[model samples]
Target: MAVPSARLALLLCLMIPATVASSRSLRKSPANASRPTTFFEVDRPLRRSSGRCSTLLLSASFGSTFNKPPATNAYSPPRCLVKAGGRASAISLAVLEWRAACRGAQLDRVFGVWLGGAELLRGSTAAPPPNGIIWSVSKDVTKYASLLAAAGKPTFTVYLGNLVNTTLTGVYHANVTLHLYLRRTPPTKPPPATAPADLVVPVSRALPLDGGLWFPIQSAADVASKSVALPSNAYRAVLELYVSFHQDDELWYKNQPGYQNGPFREVTARVDGVLAGSVCPFPVIYPGGIYPLLWRPIAPIGSFNLPTYDIELTPFLGKLLDGKAHELAFAVTNAVGVWYVGANLHLWLDPGGTATTAGLVSYVAPAAKTTSSKSADPVDTHYHATANRLVSATGWVKSSYGNITTNSTRTFALVYLLTFETLDLTIVADTGVVATDGAGGVMYSAQTHGNFPLGWVYQQNSLTVTHGLEETTVAAGRWSSAPPYRSLRTTQSSLVEDEEGGGKSWGVRQTYRYNATDGCYFRNVTSSNYSVVSDHSNELCVKGAASVGVGAVTAALPTVNLP
Candidate 1:
C-alpha cells in the first residue's frame, strides 16, 4: 500500500519521517488539530555550498506526488508508497540540486558512503581534509493515514549499517559509545512551536554479548548471567560505537553524540530479518581521518586462567522466528585485547511461524576459587569409592522482556559447571504427556518423568538444546588445564510418564527409574493431579547431591568443602 503524505507533521514530533512520497503520508505527530495558514515567498531553490561537499538539495512540490489519499477521512494516505515490488530509483552521484516551495517534501532518495563507515563525518576526500562523500535527495511532501482505535500504525523502520566494529571485551571495566542523528531540511519559516513537553521513547537497554555470559577458560568455570525479556513480537537490536574511550568509568565513553548510554543490554532483531551494522561519525581521521574507536572488548580472566572466553550465542537461536534452517555464527576477536572488529550477518530466519525459546547458559560463581595444598611434601594419595542416589533437576527457564502485550520474544541460555578428578556425575529425567479434563483443576502425566532428553545435557562446555528425547550424564575427565582441557561430556535418555486412572483411584501414576555408580545425587519434584471427583493430589520430591566431593586435588576425596 502507498503511504499518504497529508500526515507529514506529527503532533509531538518524536521520530523524523525518512520519506513522505504521498500527499497523505502519515508522519508520526502528536494528536493536535492544526492546519497550515500562511504562505511564504517560495524562495528560489535554497542554495547551500561548503567547498566541494556532495550534499544535494532536491526540489519540493505539493499535490499527491505518487498516489491519491484514502476516501474514509479524505486525508488518510496509504501506509506505504513504493510499489509492492519496485525498488526506489537509484540516486545520481552528479551535483544533485533542486528546490520546491511547499510545506514539506518526502525524501525520495539518499546515498552516503562512510570514509570508514563513520556516522558523524561527511563529504568526499581528495587533497582537502574532511574527505568523504555524502549524497541526499529529498523533497518535503505531506500525507495522512487514519489511526485505528486501539492499535497504533507502524511507521517506517530505520536500519543502521556500516558499524565501526569495536569489540566490547572485559567484564564491567571498559567503556563503549554510539552516535545517531536525523537529516533534515532547514525549514523556510520558523519551526512550529513546541508543546509543554516532548514524549520520548524510552531507550532500550544495552544487550550483552552471547546471551550475557562469556566463558573463555577451557576448564569448567561459570560467569554471572542475566537477561532482559520482551513481550512476543519482532524487534531490531541497535548497537552503538563511541569515538573516544574513558579510562575511569567501566561502561561510559567520552562525550559522543547520537549513541546509547552504557550498562550493556540485550538487543533483539526483528523476527525473520537480518541486521547489519551502520557506520556513523565517519572520517575518524580527517583527510583520511582515523575512525574513532567506539567500543572495546576486554578479557577479565588472567592470561593463565582460561585461554579463550566461550561466549554463548545459543540463547539468540530460534527466537520467536520463522525462516529456512540457518546457523547463527558470532563474529568475535581471536586476539586477547581491545580493538575494532566487524559483525557480519550470521543467521537468517525465514517467514515461517515458530515459537522462539530462551534459557540460562550456565550458573557461574562470581569470585575465583583457590585450592590449598595439604602438606609441603605431600604424600601421593589414591583412593577409589563409589555410591549412588536419585537425582532430578528443572528444565531450563525461558526468559523475556518488555510489556507482555507487545508480543516481544526474549531469548536466554542455560549453562552449568562440570568437574571430574576420579568420580563421575549422572542426570536422569522423564518426558511425560500432560493430561487435562478441559477445565482448570488438576493435571496428570500418562507416564513417569525421568532421564532428561538427549540434547538436554551440555557436554564439551557448550550447551545446545534440541526437541526430542531426555536424560543425559556428564562425561568423565574431559578436563585438562588446556585442550580437552577440563570439561564435561554427557549422555541423555528419556521415558514416557504413565497416567493415573481417573480421579482418586491411582497406584503409580508416574514411574521414574535410574541406574548409577559413585556419583552425587539429589531429586526435588513437585507434581499435582487435580480431578473433579477428588481433591487435588500432590507429589513433591526434594533432593540434592548427598556427599559433595567427587574430585580432590591429589586423590578423590569428599573431604573438600563446597559452597
Candidate 2:
C-alpha cells in the first residue's frame, strides 16, 4: 500500500546507508527493510582545504548498481554530488531526492547544499575563503527547504575527519545548501541508429527536467485535470530561499539543528504559473491525494515575530503549449501579525523547456483556459449529474479551497472561492415545454457567482492523520461533489431529456475571474479575526455578488447552451 503520509518518507534517510553501498554505487533500497548507515569516513589527513567557506565537488561514476532495475538503463544515469549534514539537512535533501537529472545534453544537476556562517567555523580545507559562504541549487519551490536562500529550512552533515583537533568537531548542520552540475563535455552529433542495441534504450529520451507541466503537489493538491500538453517533458520546478530571524533590528540565522521559530525569516519560491500548486502553513500535504509530500519547520511554534519576509516560487524549466495556455493563480494569506507580503513571485514557461535565449516572464490570474476564444463569455456552460435532480429553486453556490496560509497564532487555515468569471444561471425546469420560478410565468433563475471547477476542503484528511496512533491506517474521503453544476455534451447523450426538458446540459468550455468573497479570512481554524490590508497584506477589497440577467426560456430546447 502507498505510504499513507509523506511523513513516513522522512525516515527514508535513516535507512539510506545500508542501501547505498558506497559513494560509487547509487542504489535503490527496499521500502520495508532497514539497515545500518555508514558514517562519513575520510581516512587521509587534510590533503587540501579552502579558507573561505566553500563546497567540495566530489566526482563519482553514474554507472548503475546491481540492484537497479534494467529498465532504468534505457535512460541516462544522472551524476552529481551530495554532501551530508544534520537531521534537518538530511531530511531536506531526502525529500528532494527525485530532481537529480539535467535537461537535454546535460546529465547532472545540484542535489544538496552546504550552509555557511557558524557552520563554517569548524571543518576547514586548504582552500581560499569568503566571510560568509553558501552552496545552493538555483530554483525555488512554493514550500520551504531551499538550498541557497536563507529562508529555506534543510538539514546537512559534517564529516568527522574534518574535526581537526579542538578547533572543530564533526556533526551535522541542521541547515545545509547544495550546488550541483553535470560533468563538462562538448556537444557531439547524434549517435548512429545502427549502433549496438544496448545503447538505444539508455539514450532514447531525455529526463523530464527541461520543462512541461509538473505535479508539484503530487498528492496533496489536486486539479480538475491531470494531464496537459506542453512543448517538452523536461521541465522542472526549483525553489530557492533564505531563512533568517528578525528581532529588534538584527537578523539572526539558524544553521544548527532543531527549529528556529522567529527572529530568522527570509524565504522565497519560483514556479511555472501553469504547472504548480502550493499549500500554506509551510508543511502541508494531502496524504492520499496526488502529492504525499509534507513540510516540517525545524523551529518550534511561537518562536519569532518579525513581519516582512517572503518565500520565492520559481519554475526551473518548462515546455510552453501553442494555441492553448495555462494559468497559475497564486492565492496567499498572512500567517500572523496583521498581514503577509511576499516579494519575488516569478513564473517561467518556456515553450521548449530549455531557455536558449534570455528568459521571459508573464503574469496572469490562476485559471485554466480552453482553446476557444470564449474567456469572458459563457456561451455554453451548464452542470448535470447522473443521479441528482433539479428539485426546488433554493439558492446554493459551489466552491473549493484555493489558497491558504498561517494565522496570527502561527497555525494554518483553508479558504474557499469560486472559479470562472460569470454568474452561472441555474434554471429550474418543470416537466413541460417551459418551466417557471415561483414568482414567474415561464421563467426560473438562480445566480452562480464564479466559474466552473469550484474548490472546497474536507476535514477528514487532517483529523485521522494527526490523531491516529502508530498502527492505525488513516482514511481519506472520495472526490467531493461539485456544486449544483452540469456541462452538456450533446455527443454523449440521447433524446431522453430531463423531465422538464427545457435546457440541455452545457459543458464547462472555459473559465474566467469573478467576484471574490470574504476578501481575506482565516479558513478551517477557529480564529475569528480576519483582516484585509492594502500595503502590508497585499489584500484587495474587490467584492460583489456574481449576478446575471436571464431571459425567458422557450419550450423544450434540444441542446444545452450557455449565456
Candidate 3:
C-alpha cells in the first residue's frame, strides 16, 4: 500500500505542467529559499594593545567597531527586516549565540549581559576553556524577536568586571551571532505591537558584607507607591528578583572548619507586607567551576548565574493599578554577610483577556524563628563536636478579585545536627493551594525535602492536585555526591480522571543517573498516558562530568558561641 501511494504521488507530480514545476523549483532554489538566516555577527576584544596593563576598567559601554576596546559601550544588532508581504508569524523563531575566548589566565572575573539596559544574564569567567578552549552560549531570543524586527535598532551590551583584579595576563574576546527563522508564506495577520513596561528601579547596590550580625536593608521600599503607576488596563503583574553571592565571598569560608555548605541564610521578598517568595541558597558545585567548562549544560541557566527568585504579582496588580501606592521590600533573615540583590516589576495589560485586577484580600506573612543548642566548647574541637540548630517559617496568602479567590499556606524548616565525623543537614518545605470560583474550586499540595552530608546532597519533591474531575500526584527524588561526584534522579507521576461512573488513570515513571568517574549516564522511562503502558531505557556516555562548578558556601566564620 505504501509503495502504491508513493507511485501515485510521483505520477501526479509528473502530470504537473512543466512551467508550474519550473517556477516552483526556482522558488525553492538556495538563493530564493525562505529559511533561517544570520541577522548579525559581533566580536569585541577585551584587552588593551599598547602595553600590558595590570588592570583596565571594564565597564558597560556602547560602540560599533571591534578594533579598540572601550571602557563601556553597547552593541546594537542590525535591524531585522520583514520582507514585503511578510508578517511576524513569518518569522518562526530567533536565537542568539555568544562565544568568547581567553588566553593564559586565572579565570576569576564576572561578566554581565544586558538587553535594553536591563541585566539579562551574569556569570563568572571561571568556566571558559582553561587556556585553549573556546566558550560559547546560545539562548532563545524569540520573545524579543518581534520587538527587534519592528524597532529601528536596539542596543545590547556585555559588561565585564574583575572583582578580585588579579594580575593575570590574558586577552579575552567575545562574539555574538543572531539567527532568525523566516517563513515562505506570510501569515494572515501581523503581530501585535510591543507594549511598554515600567522602568526598572535599582533598589540597592551589590554591597559588601562584614559578616558580623543580621542587618536590615530596605533595598526597595514602596516601589509602586503613588510615584509609579501602572497603566489602567493592566491585568497582571510579576516581581523578579536577581540574587547572587560573590564568588570570593563563597571562597572566603570554603575551607573553614565547622562551616556548613550552601546558602544558609533565608532571603524573602514581600509586596505590601505579603510574603511573595523565600529562598535559602544551597550551593551545588558544578563539575568545572562556577562557570561550567562545558559552555552548554543540560539544565537551564539562570540570569544571575546563581539562583533567582520570581513571584506572580497578579493578585496585587489590582491594588497597584488602582492609582495608589504599594511597597516592595526584601528581608534577609539570619544573614551574616552581604549578598547581591536586584528587583524588577513587570505588568501585562491585555484588553482582550478578562478585564480584572489583582488585589490581596488577605495574607499572613511567613514567620521565621531559629533556635539552637550547643555544648561547651573552646578551641579544643573544630567547633563541630556538638551543635544543633532548627529554623522554621510558616505563612499563608489569600488573594481575590471579582468572585475568584486563591488561598495558600506554606511552611519551611531546616535542621542542622552536627558531629565530629559528619554534619547532618535537613530541609523540609510544604505548601497547599486552593482556588475557588463560587463553589467550584481546585486544590493543590506539595512537599519538598533536602538532606546534605559530606560532599553529597539528596532531594525529594512531591505534588498533588485536584481539579474539577481530575486528580494528579507526582513524586521525585534526586541524589548527588561529589566524592566521586555523580547523580541519580527518579520521578513517578500518576493522573486519574473521574468520568461517568468510573475513573481512568495514567501513570509515568522515569529515572536518570550519571557517573562522573566513567562519564556515563543511564535513563529509563515508563509511561501510560492511555490504557496501554510503555517502557524504555537508555545508557549514554559524555566527555566529562555532567556539570563543572564550585559548590555554594556561606560567608559566615565558624561560630564559638552557644545558644
Candidate 4:
C-alpha cells in the first residue's frame, strides 16, 4: 500500500501574502506621528554588546514529536570557558536567544527546555503564514549562573509537542543558543548585580517529556505536591510557577454555570499542611485563540514569554526552615478539563549565618467568598458573578544579619458580567496589596492587575448560527518595586474578528510599554488580514498607553505575594 504524502493532504489553505517582512531592521520608521506598520511583537531587547558572548547551546529541528520522547543532549562548558593564559574564564552572565519558523497548515504547540533536571524556559509556538514566519525571543538567565556551571556534565533536554500528519503538515525549525558573557578585569562586589537566590530547587518530577513533570489539575481535589529537605539557613523563599490551560478550560473565564465548571478558577499553594497563598491566573490568549486571523506577525499578550507567577513564601519559612523535610503543594479550585502546572523554588540563604531561628507571629487565611446568579429572558441569557480571597502571614526571624520581622499579604477580587449563550467578560485589579515588608522597609512589592473584556455578536438564521463577530480589549499591567529594581510593564489591544468571508477579514491594534530602573521600550502596531497596516516602535519608553482600552479597571482581586 502506498501512503499519501503529507504535502498532498492540504488542510485549510491560509493565503498569507507577504506585505514587506516582519522586521524593523528592513524598514526604519521616522520618529513622527505618521508611520508604516510592520509585523513584530512587543518583546524587551537585551544589550548583546555589553560584553563578550558566544552561542554554546543546541540547534536542531523538530517534527512529528507528539507522544514520543523529547530530544536530549549531553552538555558541558564550552571551550571559551578557558582562556589562553591557561586559566578559567570568568562567566558573568547568561542569555538564551530562541528563533523558530514554520509554514503550511498546523496547530500551535507548546515547547520547553530543561537543564540538569530544572526547567530553564517554557513557551508556545506561533501560528505560521503560508509564506513562512520567523520570530525571536531573548531571555536573561543570569540568575541561574550557578546551575549552568554546576559539577560534571548534565543532560540538556528540549520538548516540543508537535504533530505532523497527512492532513496537517508543518515542520518546525528552531535554533536554541546559550550565550555566556565573560567578565572583564576583576570582581569587586560581594553579590552579582542580578541578586538571584542562593539556590534554586526544582519542584517537579523526574520525567522529562512534553507534560512529564507538570501535574494535570482537572478538579479541586487534584493537588500537586512534593517533599523537600530544604536548607536550614534559608531566610527568604519564593515560588515561580508556570501554567497553561488546555481542552475545555482553555477559555476558563468565559465559561458559565451548568456548563464546564462555571466561570471561576483559583490556584492555591501550601507549605506542609498549611495554606500559604492563592491567585487568579491571567487569561492568556494563544495565537490561535478565538480567530487565527487576528494574530499574524504579532501574537497575543505574553505568548512567546509566558508570564510566571511569583508567590512570596518568606513568612512560611518559619515552618520550612526547621531543617527537616516538608511538603509543598499546589491546587486549582473548580477546575475542569486539564491544566498543566509546575514550579521552581527560589531560596535566599542568610549570608551571615549558617542557621536561623524563626517563629510565626500571626496568620490569617479565609475561604474564598463567591456568588453567582443566572437567569434567562425572552431574547438573552443573563449571568453575573464575583469571587474574593485574602491571605496574610507575619513572622520574625533572627540570624546573623539581625532580628527581621516580615509580613506578606495576598488579596484579589473578580467580577463577571455576561449575556446570551455566546458569553463574555472578566476583570481583576489590585486595591492595596503589600506583597512583602521587612523590618527596615518594603523589600519587594507588586500590584498585578488584568482586565480582559470581550464582546460576542452571533448572527443566526433559524436554528443555525451563520456568522459571528468578536471584539476583545486587553488592559493589563504589573507594577513592582524592590529599591533599585523598580519596574512597570503594561499593554492594551483592540481586536476584531469576522467569521464571514470563510473566516477572513480580521484586524487588531495594539500598544505596549515597559519602564524600569535600567531600560525602556515602546511599541504600537496595527494589523489587517494577516498583514501589517502600520507600526511604530522606539527605545524611548512611554506611559498611559496600556490604560486606553474598552473597560475600566475593576475592583481589587486576590494577588500572589511577590517577594
Candidate 5:
C-alpha cells in the first residue's frame, strides 16, 4: 500500500548494527599526503564546547569494518572523564567530530553511526581518486544527552558496509571523537539553552546491536517498526526519521512502476494501528550519481550529510499515555529492496505530574490520490503525473498544568513530468513539489516554509524536540531535474542556517545548471543518469513558486517557481 503523504523529494534524510560471519578481508588503503582533503556537507551550526570538558575516541580506523557486512564495532560511552561531583551530572553539552580519508581508487560507500540505539549520522564516503581524498564533519550532540548520561554505559557503534576486491582497491578510513562540555559551578539544572528532551526512545529492532539496529525494508510490504512503553507523565512526543534509498528505489525519479507515470514514493508513520503521517522525500544525489567525476572536489548537495525529517506525534500521545506498549512503525510504500529507515522518539515529561489524562479529538488521513498521462513518438516517450494529500488531526491532554489541546494539519502538492529519448538513451525528470506541516498548543510556536528539490526552508522555534515540533508552512514549492548528459557539466549549490533569540530556520537556497554538448538537458533543469543533483546557491536561483495549488503542473522551470 502506497503511503498517503508526499513531502520529502529533495531534502528527506540516517542508519543503524549487525553480526555476520564472513571471511571477506580488506586491506586498509594507505593515506596519500599529496591529495588535498576536499568536499563538504551541510549541517546545523556547531556550538563551541567550552568549560570543563571530556572527549572520547568513538570510532577508529573504520575502514577495517567497512568490508565487514552485518558486523559492527562497539564501544561503551565512558562517563565524562573530568571528575566534578560526577561528570554526567555536570555535563552541559556534547558534540561529535569525524575525519575520514581514502586512497588508491574505489567506489563510494554509505555508512551510519549509532549512539546507544539511536541513529546519529548517515553519510556516503566520497569516492577516492588514484591519489586519494579526505574530508571532515562536525555535529552538535547536545540533544542526546539523555543517552550519553545513562549510567549503564550505552554502547556506541558504526556500520559501514564496503567492498575491497582487486578491481576496487580503495579503502576508506574514519576516526570519530565525542566531546563533552561540562559546568564548572555546583551542579545546576542544565540551562534552558542546553536542555534537551527528558527521554529519547529508539524506534528500532531490539538489541544484540548486531551489525548495528538498523532494519532493512526489501519492499513496500516490509514495514520496520518497534513497540515502546511510555511514561505516564510524558506529555509530548516527536518522531525524527532518517531514510536512504538503495537499489531499485535509489533512482526513484526514473522508476516506471505499474501504470504510474514518472515515479512515486512516500514514507508513512503509524502509531498502534492508526496512521499518523507521511512525507515525500527529497531526491538527494549521492556523490557517485551521474558521472561521479563531476563531484570530485565538490560532492552533490545533501549527498554527504543527508537531512533528517521530523514528524510531530504529540497528538497521538492521548492514547499512548494510558501506559501500555504501543507500536511505532514506518513504511516506504512503492519501494524495492532495500530502503533503510530508522527513528528516535523525543519525549517530554510533566515536571511534577505522575500521570496525565488525554484523549484523541479527531483524525483524518486518506491514501494519496494520483493521476498520470503519457505521450509516445516513433523514438521518444513522455510521462506526466500529479499527486496530492492532506492530513489533519486534533487531540487534548490534561496534566498538572490543566487541559491543553493540540491540533495539526499537513499538505503535499507535487507534479512530475519527464521525457525519455530512446535514440539518445536519455531521461529527463523534473519535480515541482511543496509541503506544509504544523502543530499547535505546544510550549513553543514554530514553522517551516518552502518546497523541495532545488530550494526549501525549515525553521524551528524550540531547542527541545519533544515540545516544539516545526510546523512547515510552505507558501511555495521547488523544481529540479536529472537528465543523462554527455561531457562538461557544471553544478552549483549552497546552504544557509540562521538563528536568533531561539528562532531558527535552515534557509536552504541552492541553484545549478547541467549543460552538455548533447543538448540532452535544459539550462534550468539538471542532467543526470537518474540520480538527483544540485549546486551552489549564490550563483543562481530559479524563481520559486509562492504556493503549490491543487493539481498544478508546469512545463518549464521558470513556470514551476513563480515570483
Candidate 6:
C-alpha cells in the first residue's frame, strides 16, 4: 500500500532533569575538550521542568496512535545560552536512540529539527532491526551554536512523515540529547572583531515537479537586512542552504525495468545565478530479514541520518557584496518528489574596510546535461535501455583589491552511465469446469512476468578555490544488480588534492568494493609511498601507493579584498 497524503504525526515533549545522565558511550567524541557540560534530554510524552535549561522531545506515532488525528507541535525553550553574550566553545546534537515500534514494517520516515524557523538538521529513520536493539547517531552542530544560543522565544520544531504506506500500525520513538559547552574564561584570542549577519529567504514549501517526475526545485530571494546595508564593506561572505526532501516509496518507476530510483540523486547550489557546488544525497534503506547480510555489517545499524548540505558561496561574494540588493537561489536536481528548502546568507564585515571592488568577469553555464536511448528487438518483442547523464559547471571570478588584480575559475564535471535489458515472457493456464448428472467441464488462464538486468556507473570531478588556493576532487562509483534484481553489489572511490600553486602537489585516493553474497565483505585500497600494500581483516581492506611530480597546477587563482 502507498500513503496518499504522505504526512506523519509529531509529538513534542519538554524534559528537564535535575541530574542528566550521560549516554556518551553510544557515540565517539571529538578530542581536545574540557569538562563541565550541560545536557538537555528530549523524549516521549510532554513534560515540563522548573529548571532554567529545558529539553524538548519529538516523537512520531502513526495509524492507530492518532486517535484524535495528528497535528503539528511547536516548542520554545525558556532561555537560550547564545543570548547570554560570550562566545560559544562547542555544541553537538546526539541522538540517543531511534527505534521503530514492534508492529511497524516497511517504514520510511523523515526527521527534521529547526530553530527559530531555520533548519538545523534533518535525516531519515533507519529500517527496523531484526534483533530490536536501538541505534544511536550524532552530529557536530558547533557552527550553529550561535544561532541556538541567541534564540529568544524562537520556534523549535521537529517534523516526521512517512514516505510509503505500510499495513502495520506502530509508534516511532526518537530521543535527541543536546550538549552545550560554554567557555568560562575569555583569555584566548578575542572573538572576531565583528560577527556575520544573517539574511534569510523562504523558498517553496513543496519541491516542484518536472517532466512528470520531480525534477530539480529552485527559488530565489532578494538580499536585505534591517540592521545594516546589504554586504557593506565585507571581508568574507558565506551562504548556507537548508534543504529537505519528502520522498515516496515509489521513488523509482517500478514499471520501468533497469532504472534506479533514488540512490544516485544529486543536489547543487547557486548564488547570484552562478554555480557554487553540488552534492549527492545518501540513499536511505530499511532492510528486512530477507535483505543480504553483507549490508548489515557495513550499513548504519538502526538509523538513517540525513546530512545537511553546505556550500561556500564566498567566491560569489565579490559580486554579492556590492552594497546592493542581490538575488540568491538554490536549485536541486535529479530529485523524485516534494522537498522543502530555506536559505541563509552570512557576511563578515571588516572594520574600517573599503567597499568590495571584485566583480563577475566572464561566466559560462555548466555544459551539464542528461540523455537516454532505447532499442527494441527486430521481432518487436523485447527492448534494451541506456542513459547517459553529464553533470558539469564552470565559473570565473576576478577581483581588484588595492593594486593586485587576480582572476580565478572553478570547473566541475560528473558523468553517469546506465544500461539495462528487460526480459520478456508469456504463460498460459487452464481453468474452467462444470458437472451434472452426466456432464463435463472446461478452464483457461493467462499470465506474464519480466526480469531486468541493471547496471550504473558515475564519476565526479570538481575544482574549487579556497583562501586564494585551488582544490580539486574526483570521485567515482559503479554498481550492478543481478537479473531478477533481488540484491546489489557496489564499488566506489574518491581522490582529493590541494594545489600549492607550485610545481608539486599532494593528495590521497581511496577505493571500496562491497559484495552481497559470502556473508557480505569489502576490499579497500589507499594510495601510499608508490608501493606498499597493507592487509587487514576489516569488512573493507586497504592497499596503498603514492606519486610525485604527477603534474603542474593549472586552475586559475583569485585575489580577494579581505584577509
Best by TM-score: 4
- Candidate 4 regions exceeding 4 Å error are 1-40, 77-93, 181-194, 208-211, 421-424, 429-503, 541-563
Whose TM-score is higher: candidate 4's or candidate 5's? 4
Residue 482 miss distance in model 5 (angstroms) = 35
Q: Where does model 2 exceed 4 Å of error?
A: 1-332, 337-363, 366-563
lDDT winner: 4
How many residue pairs clash per model? 157, 115, 22, 8, 33, 13
Tens-place lDDT digits, model 6, residues 369-424: 43333445333222222222222221222222121122222222222222221111
| RMSD values, in order shown | 31.1, 27.3, 22.5, 9.1, 15.4, 23.1
Cα deviation in Å at residue 138, candidate 4?
2.1
Q: Which scores greater on lDDT, model 1 or model 5?
A: 5
Q: What is the lDDT of every predicted structure here?
A: 0.18, 0.18, 0.36, 0.61, 0.54, 0.32
10 residues in a row with least lDDT, candidate 1: 292-301
lDDT per residue (tens digit) for residues 50-156 in model 5: 66354555545544454354334455454544345554446565777777887766777777778767887787888776667788777676677677666565666
> How well does model 3 score by local distance difference test?
0.36
Compute the lDDT for candidate 4. 0.61
lDDT of 1: 0.18
Clashes of 6: 13
Ranking of all predicted structures according to TM-score, beginning with the best and ending with the worst? 4, 5, 3, 6, 2, 1
Ranking by lDDT: 4, 5, 3, 6, 2, 1
Give the CA lDDT, 0 to 100, for residue 5 in model 2: 25
Q: What's model 4's TM-score? A: 0.79
Clashes in candidate 1: how many?
157
Q: Give the TM-score of candidate 1.
A: 0.18
Per-residue alpha-carbon lDDT of model 4 for 171-256, expressed as tens digits?
87888888877666534332311256667788876655554456678776798888987788877677778787877787777666
Question: Which candidate, 2 or 4, has the higher lDDT?
Answer: 4
Query: What lDDT score is found at residue 345 in candidate 1?
Result: 18
